[model samples]
Target: MWKYLKIVLALCGFILNTMILHTNPINDVTNLISIIEKLRPLHKKLGKPGPHDWLAHHHEPGQTFQEYYKSNPMTPRGKRCVIYIQPLGEFTQVQRRIVVLTSDFMSRFYNLQVKVQKDIPLSVIPNKARRRHPEWGVEQILTSYILNDILKPKLPADAAAYIALTISDLWPGRGWNFVFGQASLRERVGVWSIYRNGNPAESENSFRLCLLRTIKTAVHEIGHMFSMSHCVKYECCMCGSNHREEADRRPLWFCPECMAKVCWATCSDPVDRYQILAEFCEEHGFNNEKEFYKKSIAKLES
Candidate 1:
């Protein structure tokens, strides 16, 4: 009798952990499913990768909604609803403007409060963590230090994710030449650089491109901080990239699976998110992005 009772109790525990853990209430899940279905047509189904694309170079199994839920991904709630951005170096006037715009966009993207902390000088980076590229000669800072030592320790009590944005280039450790950015998902900390985002002062087009690239990387890294992994199922913003060309090939929007993760985590309304994004893109003359968002809204409403 004791052995039979123990087996029954174990089965009940397993069922609850798999089905109920990390999921919203039954009604909320139903509503999210309905929203995802309506917004489906606005997003293209990913077909095949090009010769030099991320999927061609890397093998990722991709994370589905079920996998994400089982992972117990972090969500914004109560006091932990703020996203914080820490500036680590000097910025040109245009670069500064890009930072300002990105902060504003982030707030709307995740439906959370975004706070830009006071600027911290690059001088704070120790000499050991600073290096010059062997051939390119461009100076680079260590990304791990910023993530582990700086942002993690300084993370705010109310922060959902703490991100550091710097104008300087970054390299993760000793293996690579340089990296665009790096983030630790479990730690809820990350860092990115605008150095390779293109020179915003070059031309009007350059400025716009720089801004778009910066926003893409910023949000992508933040997505990781939410425990979202590289998107293998679609050509979404959550897709991993090995190089600039590959990254640029992906759309600035989330695919259905990845979109569900974000909306679930943030408790955001998909229609409202699309409307705000459309408005922001339109105001910034991001016509292509703006049109996509508008179409997403249309699909949801229709």
Candidate 2:
């Protein structure tokens, strides 16, 4: 089953790549390049990574706007533009609210329509695909099972990406412990666990933290689905993280280069995008992030 699934995924990637190559360049390429240049100084360069940081453990060449365009990266095109979110399993009132807000943020982030599907019960998972952590005694469902057996089979025809949002803990396989999320760039299927994102019912601060983490992971994985490599150029949300501290340290907004990629891919106006993002941050009390987006708008418009 695994082998067959792998072959199918590879074939899907090849077809997608072929489509990208034949697709015409985005009409606003020059405008996006200008926007990147305009906002360049406002973005900060990524510094040396700590020993436990993602970059320290994994070497990524990083993707620049030019490289991304030249490679004919995937974008939401034709009927495959909507991002679909499938909730798998139960959620507390707080967690459910967080998921709703995250979906709204994703819509604004990508400038695409987002649909939250009805819940798919956890009963679908079988015994072979679940385990209890030997050391921690925590229950976790197999991420591969969710990605392959569940998400891939039901992926909506109009979905550019179909992601499962779950409150259950997730494990990729035996060698690993737990993953916050996993995504198949080729298959456009992903599953994320909010079990480790902290209990949102704790306090207002905790709720905000949980929401921030959820938003970060959602956009990050979806960004991967768009053929975006990890951002090594700046302290952008696209930058990879190995742990919670590193993820928390990263900003919610993309850097100038990455911002351009999102704009070009979505055919969004940079100023308008920043404005909408800033409003979301303000509404959600993300004061710091709000200020950053506002500043980005200023830089671009200046």
Candidate 3:
């Protein structure tokens, strides 16, 4: 039964990838294979997804390095070198600090400059775009409106991608309760809410946890903007997430396959990137995360 299920899932993934990616087939993939091979031993293989996990529910074929290269994926180059973060609403001092830290970390992660834009008042979201959840009664903001109407129009000419960060809760549309965030591959615009990241002012641990979550979401969304698909091959930041618990379970680092894409997309040096990432994690008390990055760097340098 499990073997048959695996075949069915593989077929579903192939079909979905063909439909959505739509890039010319790649050939002479030797270099790509070499890169994946070199980094493979440094990463962990993904276990089967749980019954309610993202992969269990949605079939997605992970993108290969050559496929991404041939897809005319958005790379940071020329004028499109800056990542712009648009502030959507007011935030507490701690929340504001989280936003600032997120921007800084994003700059280092993608090796692209990041700029936080002037704050856009929450009042800009009209009654039509705001809601109160019927059951939970939590105030929510419409994600589509922000992506299409707000950020798209105002996206900077020099932006590699424009992202919005907000304190207000987010709901994608009808039939959903809430979302941590959402992004557009074609539009170069995305938005995420830190409302669900937990209040940072509560305690030191909570603050660190909130920062880690925010950084993960920020970088993951931007990865999508680069036309990188969910990673099916390993436990990775690019893997699709089904819920908060599942997302938290995923690491803050990219798997070998996804790392290759990021390195290629940003034209970054893998060793240097790992070193800086480790330093950031260590400074913020993410000891385990710090050690993992350090190990990756050592393996790469060796």
The candidate maximizing TM-score is 2
Residue 170's lDDT within candidate 2 is 90
Regions of model 2 farther than 4 Å from truth:
1-27
Over the stretch 1-302, how does candidate 2's per-residue lDDT look in tens digits? 99999989878886885466334254266777787888888788999999989899889999998888677676787668899999999888889999899999999999899999999999999999999999999999999999999998898988989999998989999777877788876778988888888989999999999999999999988988888889999999999888889988999999888887787788777788889999999999999999999888888767
Q: List the residue pairs that clash in candidate 3.
A: none
- Summed backbone clashes in each candidate are 0, 0, 0
lDDT for 177 in candidate 1 is 74
Please write out the lDDT profile of model 3 over residues 137-168, one tens digit for every residue.
99999999999999988989889899999999
Report lDDT (Cα) of residue 226, candidate 1: 91
Q: In model 3, what is the error at residue 269, expressed in angstroms?
A: 0.6
Q: Which stretches of candidate 1 lie above 4 Å from their native place? A: 1-27, 50-52
Q: Which ten residues in a row have the lowest lDDT in candidate 1?
A: 18-27
Best by the lDDT measure: 2
Model 3 compared with the native: what TM-score? 0.87
